[model samples]
Target: MIETRILTADDWRTWRELRLAALTEAPDAFGARLADWQGDGDREERWRARLAIPGSHNITAVLDGRPAGMVSGVPGPRGDTAELISLWVGPEARGRGVGDHLIQEVERWALRCGVGVLRLAVAPGNTHAGALYRRHGFAATDEPGDEMASGEREIIMVKYLTAEDRTARDVTAGDLSGGCAPPADSAGCAPRADPVPGG
Candidate 1:
């Protein structure tokens, strides 16, 4: 079974461990390099600050009994939107529905925040990640995203949130089976102080 746990600054240690693993395993998938988070940069305060990104929501997925995936939703560049960031699924959980669960959790959080759009930037050439986002209703936009350290522009994708979308999500939110498990993709945020009640 796949279960998700909403994390907070207090869970920095857990977040730190999974984040380092993601950066190391999928070095090309994230904007932040693993080396950036190591050495002196690997301070406890830094990890705490990341998890405490003002109005951000952090989630880690547990497949059966092990941590298998992580994702974050933070207030976007625009107030009406939220950004999904730092998405990663462990190798052991790739064929499972962990990625879907993580994305759905963030979508629920965005709906509760009343955000009109959810945005994300997938690294160029990460086709699996791009297709995964597409399946979840995100589409590429002409708008440019942040330039990576390598000076390449990431592919920006956005999913517009509407009343109808919310209604449909509400109906299926409780169905944890998430249908067939899509191949987990490492792609890669929103919300209020208490965005998601009851975690």
Candidate 2:
């Protein structure tokens, strides 16, 4: 069973755990490095501040009682947009619907915040991640996105929330009451994807 929990600064420890695992397992997927959050840099206050980003929603997916994935949504500089960030799924939970659930949660939140567009950035050469975003209605744009530490530009994808999309979401709002449910088999779920470090 997979479940998602809305996280606050108080749940920084859980966020920290999943974050470290993400950076360690997929160093190429994010702009930030594991060392950036390790050693003396791994302080309690730092993790707390990360989760406390103003106007941001942080979520962690729990699979059978263990932390499985993490993602965040922060209102963009423009009032009408929100950017998805920090998306990662543990190997044990990959292809189990955790990634889809995390993304959907952010989409629902963006709708509530009245944002017309939801955006995200992907590392270049990450074809699987791009496909996953495309499946969720995000399209790559020619616009430049955040620059990574490696001097590469991230791929920007946007999903414009139309009136029809809003109405469909409204009709299914009740489905948000429970945790995300994975298919009976791994093959039934789409492969999970990674996002740029901060978006």
TM-scores of the models, in the order given:
0.84, 0.84
lDDT score for residue 192 of model 2: 23
RMSD of each: 7.9, 8.7
**Model 2, TM vs. native:** 0.84
Q: Which ranges in model 2 have alpha carbons more than 4 Å from their true place?
A: 169-199
| lDDT of candidate model 1 versus the reference | 0.76
Q: Which pairs of residues clash in candidate 2, taking residues 3 or more apart in a chain or in different chains?
A: none
lDDT of 1 by residue, 15-96 (tens): 9889999988998888888888999889988888888666676889998788899998876655578888899999889968
Candidate 1 deviant stretches above 4 angstroms? 168-199
User: What TM-score would you give candidate 1 relative to the actual structure?
Assistant: 0.84
| 109-195 per-residue lDDT for model 2 (tens digits) | 776666689988899977877888898999999999778778889889999988876666562344442112221221211222333
lDDT of 2 at 172: 37
